[model samples]
Target: MEKRNDPQLRLGEEFFNQPCLSLAKAFLGKVLVRRYADGTELRGRIVETEAYLGGEDRASHSAGGKRTERNTAMFMKPGTIYVFPIYGILLCMNVSSEGEGAAVLLRSLEPLRGQTLMRELRAARRKEGAPQLKDKDLSNGPAKLCQALNILRCFDRRDLASDPDMWMEREPDTNPAEPHDIVSAPRVGVESHGEWAEKPWRFYLRGNPCVSVVNKDAERQSGSVTDNVRSLTCAV
Candidate 1:
C-alpha cells in the first residue's frame, strides 16, 4: 500500500455505518484524535476494541431493547459518541454502529502524539503517591485512554464525524493491518452474561503491547473464534 501525505482525513458516518463487529475490527490501526480547549492535540492509534451487538446481545447495555438516558447514544445514528462512567469515577467511550442498539467499545490505544499531555492527564487522575505510568500503560485500557484523552461523560451522544474536540481519523501514510495481524477474543468483565460472556466480540492488534488484557487461549484459537463471530453475525 502506498502512503499518502494527507493527515486530515477524518472518518465520517459512512466509515462508521458498518455492523458493530465489522466496525470493531476496522477500528484497529485507525487514529483517534482528541483536541483540548488549550489548543493541544492528543493522538493515539486504536489498538483494541470490543463489539456489542444490539438488543439481542445479553451483555450489552441495551440488551432486550432496553433504552436509558445513559445508553441512548447506542440507538443514535452511526458515529455518535457514547460516553459512560464505570466505578463511579472513570469513563469509557464507545461509538454507535449500524445496528439498532449496537456499538463498539474502544478498549485501548497506542499513544502516537502528545505523550507529555497524555502522561500529565493520566497522572492527575491517580493518587499522588502512585508510581509514574510507563509509556505503554498510558492508554492501555478503556478508562485509561479516556482519562489520558480527557474524554468526559458530557461527550455522550455527540457526533464523532462533526465533533471538533474528538473524532477518529485515518492515516494515509500508515499501511492498513492485515487479517492475521488482528486477534479476536471474548470481552473483558461481564462474565455473568452466561453464553454471551464466552462470545468472541473483542478484537485487538496481535502482539500489541498497548492491549489491556490479552487472552492467550483466544489468540491460539483466533481462526476458529473469527469463524464463530462470523457465524454469529450471519445468525443475527
Candidate 2:
C-alpha cells in the first residue's frame, strides 16, 4: 500500500505537471478528505467528473479569453479547488489544472465516511419535507456532494495544498467503477457555445446514485436530457 501521506500534505509542484483532464480522469475512485470546521473529517470517493479546458475550448468558462470573476480560478495553479454555483442552486467543484489556464469541473461524488454528518446537513430540508437523501443521494450532484462533504462557497479558490482543512487522499479502492460503464455527454447549459455544446465531454459513474441526473428534476425546467451516466471523462 502507498504509505499514508501526511494529512497536511503540501503536494510537490511536480503534481501540477500533467494533462488536466487526464489527471481528472485518473481521479475517479480516489478519495477526498475534508477536515470540517467542526473538527470532524469527512470523506468521499470521486465517482463523476467533467473536464473544461480553458481558452480554445468554446464550452469552457474561460473560452475566447472571456474571463469572469467566477472563472478566475481556471488560471490558478494545478490542484486548486474551483467551487462555483450553478443556476443559483447547486454547487459544482473544480480542480484547477491543465495548461497555463485550464480546469476540470468535478461534477459528482459518492459519499463515504461522515455520512451521518452529511445526512445532518440535509436535516433542515428533510424537516421541510424536501427530498430525503438515500445514502446514495447525499452527494449525487456537485452542490449536493459539497453539502454531503460540508464544503461551502468559502472553499472557493481555496488552495488544496498547504490547507490541512481539506485534502484528497488515496484510500482503499472501495467500489472500483469501470471505464466501459462510464458515459460521456456534452455539458449542460451554455447552448450559445454552438458546436461546443454538441461535444460529448461529460462523464459519471455507472448506476451510481451519487452521479448527478443529466437534465434531471424536470419540474425545474432545465437543459436537454441524457441518460449518459459514467465515472470519468478525459477532454483529450
Candidate 3:
C-alpha cells in the first residue's frame, strides 16, 4: 500500500478520556481528520463503536482476567491504538486505555480519504457480490476503515496523542445528529454470551451506508467482501 498524501494533525490530551464508551458515543458524527506531515488531509465520520473495560467487561478481550502482549496497550494511557485480526479476516481497530484500562472498540467508519483508491478497493469487494460504495461506502467496518486508510498493525499501540505518523483530528464543521436519529443494535458476532450479548452499546449513524451489513444482508446473501483484505499476521 502507498502512503496517503494527508497532512498530520497535532494530537492532544483532551482527545484521551477515561471510560471510552461515552467518548465513543460523543465521537459519532464527528470528523476524525488525519493529515500527513506532507499536508494532505483524510477524514472519516465515526459510525460504530463498542466499549471494553479491563477484567470487568465480560464481552471485552481483556475481560475475565485475560492479558497478553496483545492487550498490553489497553492498560496504557488513553489515545493509543489497539489493532488486531479476527476470524482470519477483519483487522479490528480499537482505542486503548481509559480510566485504569478501558478501551473503545472502533467497529466501523464512514470514509473520507484517498477517494480514488478507496473506490477501487470497494469495487473489488462489490464485484464479489458485496455492498457498493458511493462516498459513504469507502470505510464502514473496522477492517475496511483500515483498508481505506492504509492502517496496519504498525499503528497498533502507537500513541495517537503524540504520533505524527497517525493521529485523530476534530472537524470544526461537524453536524451533530439527534440522539433519536441514532440507531442502537446488538453487536455483530460474539453471540455466545446469551443475554449479555444483547446489550445495545453498538451504535452507528442510522442512515449511513458505510456500515457493514453482514447480518442485515445475510438473508439476501449479496454481500461478500474479500475475507483476506490484508493482515500480515492472519493465516492464509
Candidate 4:
C-alpha cells in the first residue's frame, strides 16, 4: 500500500460517539499522529487498546460517577483526550467516549514514522548507564508510547479532534493485501478487582510484534501475583 502523503485527516467526534467497547475495537488499525512544535510528526498505527466502561467498571476512575480534577475530561464530549499519570511518573492516554466517564485506553502502537525521534526521546529518559530502548519496545506500553510521542501532562484534557498538535486518523485502507487479524483478551493488571478484572476488553492485532503484554494466564488470573521479573515497558 502506498503511504498517504497528503495532509492527515483527524477522526471526528462522531467517530468516538459510540459505546466504549465498540470504540475500543474500532480504534484498532487507526493511525495516531503527533505533530511537534518544530513541524516534525511522529506517527504510529494503533495495535492495542482497552475499554473502560465508565461509571460501571470498577477499574475505571469514573466508576460511581465520581468526577475530580483528573477525570473531568472523561465527562466531556466524545473525542476529548483524557490523559493521566500512573505510578506518579507514567502517563496514560485515553479517548473519551459518548457516555460520561466512558473512555478507551490506547495500549500499544506499531511505529510508522519518526522512529529516530522516538528512539532519541526514549533514550533520554533512561537513567545514566541504562540500556538503550529497543525499536519494538519504544511504544509498546502506554506510558512509554506517551514518552516516545512527547505527550505529557500538558496534553491532559485536550480536544483530540480539534487539537493541532495531536489527533487520530482512520486506517487508510481496510483491505490491505495482508489484513491484520483482530484478537481480544482481558486487560493487563486490575486483577484485584474480582469480576470486573475478567472483562475481555483488551483488543490487539493478532501476532503483531508491537503488542505489549499478552499473558493469557495472567489475564485470567483472579489474584495479582508477586513476580520478581525485571522488564521495561507506554500510551497516546
Candidate 5:
C-alpha cells in the first residue's frame, strides 16, 4: 500500500514513449492522481482506454499531420496531457504517446480517493440539484471523469510525468491485468471515421463496473443495466 504522505510512484516519460496501442492496454489498473492547489488529493483506477494512431489514422485529430491550435497538444512530447472540450461543455482527457501525433484517450476510471469531492463537482455540473451518485456513475466516462475531478482546459499540454497537479501511478505490488481480464472493441463514437472506426482500439477491463461500456457478453452476464451501461458519446 502507498503511504499517505509518500510521493506516489508515477509512470515516467519512458513509460508513455511507446506505441499507443501498448500504452492504452498498459494503462488499465494504473492509478490516476489529482493533487489540487489546496493539497487535497483525488484518486481513481484507470479502467478503460482508447488508442488513436498518428497521422495515418483518420480518426485522430492529428491525422494527416495537420497542426492546429486545438490539436497542438497531440504533437507534444510523450506523457503530455491533451485535454479538450467537447460541445464547449464537457472535457475529455488523453495522454500523448509514441513520439508525436499519437495518444490514448482515458475513457473511464473507478473512483478511489476523494469520493465526496468527486460527487460534489459532478452534482455542481448537472442541471438537477444535489443527488446521490453511485460509485460507478461518478467517473464512468471521459468527460464525466473530468467533471468529477475538476479537470479543465488549463490542464491541456501538461506533462503527466512532471506535473504537480495531475499524474498517473502504479502500485508496486499490483500484478498486470491478464488477457482474460481485458476486452477490446471499436472505439466509441468514431464510426464517422469509416474504416478506422472498425479498429478494435478501445480497451477496457473485463467485468469492471467502472468501464464506460461493457462488452455484450459482460453486459448479458451482469444483468443489472446500470452496472454495464454505455456512456453517452460526446466526442472522440
Candidate 6:
C-alpha cells in the first residue's frame, strides 16, 4: 500500500496523544482508512469506541499492569495499533492512548467507501450457508468492522500515524461531534469486571445507526457516573 500524499488529512501523533477516555470520545466522527496491497482504499466513519484505563481497568487486557506477548501493543506509544483475537477466531482493533497500557477500542464504524469490497470480505468469512449481510450490518460491530476492513492480527503494533496501509483522518465534511451528540454508556461485554463494568467508558455518536448497540436505559443511568469518570480519566 502506498502512503497517502496528503499529510494534512491523516491524523498525527498529537491527535492521539490524549487520555484513553478522551480519545475514545474523540474518535467519533473520525475517518478510519485502510489501503489494500492492490491500492483499494476502504474508508469508514468511526461511530463507537470504548476506553480501557490500563492497569486500573480490570476489563482491560493489561489489567494489573500485566504484560504478555499478545498485549504488548497496549503498552506502546499513542497511535500504536492493538489487534487482538476474540472467540478464538475473530479479531478486534484498538489504538493505544496516553497512560501506560491505556487504549481505546474501536467498537463500530459506518462504512463510507468500498461497500462492495467490505461486503465481499465479510461474506468470505461467513459460513457457506449463512445469510448474506446487509449494508447496515457490514461494519457495525468490533469484529464485524475488523472483517469488513481486513484488520488481522498482523496489524497489531503498527503505528496508525505512519502506517501506509492503515491510518485515521479527520472528517473532512463534518464538524466534530458536539457533547450533546455524543452518548456515553458502560462498555459492552465486560460485566465480569465488577464495578468497572458499569463505568461510562463507552462512547458513540448519538442516533448513529451504525453503532453496535444502543442502550437507552444505560445512557439515562450513566449521567452522573459519566461526569465522575471523566473527571478521573480525562486529566491526561
RMSD of each: 5.6, 7.4, 12.0, 9.1, 8.0, 5.0
Clashes of 2: 5
State which candidate, 1 or 6, has the greater lDDT: 6
Reference-based lDDT, each prediction = 0.91, 0.69, 0.66, 0.82, 0.87, 0.91
After TM-score superposition, the amount by which residue 68's alpha carbon in candidate 4 deviates from its true location, in angstroms, is 0.7
Task: List the lowest-lDDT window of 10 residues for candidate 3.
Answer: 218-227
For lDDT, the strongest prediction is 6
Q: Over the stretch 94-166, how does candidate 4's per-residue lDDT look in tens digits?
A: 9998887999999999998989999998888888888877778889989888988988888888898788889
Report residue 123 deviation for candidate 1 (angstroms): 0.8
Candidate 2 minimal-lDDT segment of 10 residues: 219-228
Error of 3 at 126 (Å): 8.5
The TM-scores of all predictions, comma-separated, are 0.90, 0.77, 0.75, 0.85, 0.88, 0.90
* Candidate 2 or 1, higher lDDT: 1
Where is model 2 more than 4 Å wrong at Cα?
Answer: 1-13, 125-127, 173-178, 214-236
| Worst window of 10 by summed lDDT in candidate 4 | 227-236
- Model 5: per-residue Cα lDDT at residue 97: 93
lDDT ranking from best to worst?
6, 1, 5, 4, 2, 3
lDDT of 4 at 105: 95
Can you write out model 1's per-residue Cα lDDT over 16-58, one digit (the tens) per residue? 9999999999999999988876667889999999999989999
**Which of candidates 3 and 5 reaches a greater lDDT?**
5
Candidate 2 per-residue lDDT, tens place, 117-220, comes to: 88988674455766656888877767777777777787877876656677776554344445554556667666788988866666665556677765333312
- For model 3, residues 109-228, the per-residue Cα lDDT tens digits are 777665776666557545576565667657767777776766778778888777766666655555566564456566767698676587666766666777665344322221122223
Question: lDDT value for candidate 6?
Answer: 0.91
Q: Order the candidates by TM-score, highest first.
A: 6, 1, 5, 4, 2, 3
C-alpha-based local distance difference test score of model 2:
0.69
- Give the Å error, residue 30, model 5: 0.5
> What local lDDT does model 5 show for residue 11?
87
Q: Please report the TM-score between candidate 4 and the true structure.
A: 0.85
